[model samples]
Target: MDNFIGEIRLAGFGFPPKGWALCNGQLLPVNQNQALFSLLGTAYGGNGITTFGLPNLQTRVPLGMGQQGGVNYPWGQAGGEAAHALTTAEMPAHTHALTGSAGGATALGPANNLLATPAAGALYGTGTDVSLASSSVGPSGSGQPHQNMPPYLVINYIIALVGIYPSRS
Candidate 1:
């Protein structure tokens, strides 16, 4: 089947087919590949006057152009991270509860009174004395960039260098 100029496809092989070029963000001379240059322009990358760049699909996934589901992704816009480290603000708000006896009956005279209303001369007792504390959780993880990519099979993305130019309907 004939492919339209600038059309991209996945291939399992290392090399591109006769009329296709690997989409590795390589620059091509305008005088040589004028047909592809006319369609692609410098949307991907290039000097525009003497050279134009093919779409770079290396370690990147292609997203549909335009807005969808209230999210606007303009054409040729590339933005994303391979891994993300969350900040304290991103975590849920919470507190830690701690409870323990301030002292035994021997040290505080008796365990009959609570810490709030301790025995006359005693410091504290093994009574209802709950200590509440609030603190931020310590950071975890090795701070390494985890693989953000989904499970995928390796493949090469190739663009048609020579083909029929498409027209708007």
Candidate 2:
């Protein structure tokens, strides 16, 4: 019998103003707000991580992600919060990303091989410190996504997650 876990989402994002970090001579922060996370979820999941950057990508100051493809994507603003797309790269890093629906091999690492960090390619981040980042909700770069981590998600699960709000509303 073959079973599949719908989606392994790294939702519920919140953090302190630990402020930003300087990597590769770039200054960026780790903590983010709910709204920004929302936009990230939309741009990343809605528009397809493969396309449609955030809203306020242009206004991004690019504190440090220049070396790792710093391209700001924008979003619509409301109130004082800037309508910017929280760079996917800023997230804590996908510590244990999923592989696929069927759930691939278990290498004593991430259960889902599909979302795990890459062995080689554009090793983005803020410095020569190439480390394995967590996926349980994190931040992105200023101008662009940190690395094309090939975000993983189950459509139905995401829809279900969004459906919760509509139903409540």
Candidate 3:
């Protein structure tokens, strides 16, 4: 008997059915579980360079932060610290610092000079001094808070299908 003459009916319609099985050329029920997962790891499609899809095997995968390696993507840092997703409490706190500059040796005496250094012992918005190297600015060196940021994960993989496979119960 010729295998091509066998009937191949779709088990389900519309969205891809979970564990949907497709028959090989022989009309035998194919393993849906193995078939779907095998689609992963293989590149979906892209420029075949820095931009490519990752194998998506898990049902639940985060879809965020995809930066091309050779592009000017805003990845926090490279080969840096691994930071977990920030919770609400870990977000940056907002603060407005008084900003101004006085040139004279004498201190200003009114509300206009609220940000000025009143005396030797008075300091507002004062904290530890940060040291900056000449190379720290511009495209020469790392910027402020010079430390590694949390590693970021990028998601660019997707799995969509139609039809279904009959359960093997």
Candidate 4:
């Protein structure tokens, strides 16, 4: 008659039988979909993020000029863009605790540096850039493995995971 007692059950030692439904609980991994996606966002015989992640740009900057964001004629500007493209304003609310330590992680390079720019011609990161889409961090920011990233800085590792949800499902 009690809800707690009714929710407890142990199945026979075999695969779930057809027509039997498994009650849902909290999903184990925060990014459970990652299991279906590879490091590149593809899985189960599907095209990966590499194939669908980037937006087609007709105006990819010429060989040189002024800073065109990351493609301004410096480092190829890879590895750190896809994640910081959007602002926490656009992310889901934070509901968990943090799992890692940015500890003292600080933003490197200037706001004008190409590597610090998002490939979509956006200016943003865990650093200060007026044009940043999601330019803040800290335990109170937004979605995090556990807690929101620290404010005023974008830890290096979190910046890395932003792009590839990297799943196997």
lDDT agreement with native, every candidate: 0.83, 0.31, 0.35, 0.31
Sorted by TM-score (best first), the order is 1, 3, 2, 4
For model 2, the superposed segments whose C-alpha errors exceed 4 Å read 1-99, 103-106, 115-136, 143-169
User: For model 3, how does the per-residue alpha-carbon lDDT over 1-169 read when each residue is reduced to its tens digit?
Assistant: 2111111233334332342222311121123323332332123332332232333222222333466666543322223233344444655876656576564325556655545545565555778998888676523323334333445443322233232422346
lDDT tens readout by residue for model 4, 37-146: 23323211234432312111112211323466565544222222223434677779877754533233234543533333233433444865565345364334454345
* All candidates: TM-score: 0.72, 0.13, 0.20, 0.12
- Relative to the true structure, candidate 1 has a C-alpha RMSD (angstroms) of 6.9
lDDT of 1 by residue, 1-169 (tens): 8899999999999999898999999999999999889898998899999999999998889998999889899888888877886666877998866544555434344366434434356554568866555444555567555667788887999999988999988
Q: How well does model 3 score by local distance difference test?
A: 0.35
Candidate 1's TM-score reads 0.72
| Candidate 4 local Cα displacement, residue 79, angstroms | 4.8
lDDT of 4 at 21: 22
Model 1 scores worst on lDDT over the 10 consecutive residues at: 101-110
At residue 75, what lDDT does model 2 achieve? Answer: 35
lDDT of 2 by residue, 1-169 (tens): 2211111222233221122111111111213233233334443232333232223222222232223347443532222233345545545755665445433333545544454344554334666765566764554345732333344432211111111222223
- In Å, residue 11's CA in model 2 sits off its true spot by 58
Candidate 2 at residue 155, lDDT? 22
Best by TM-score: 1
lDDT-based ranking: 1, 3, 2, 4
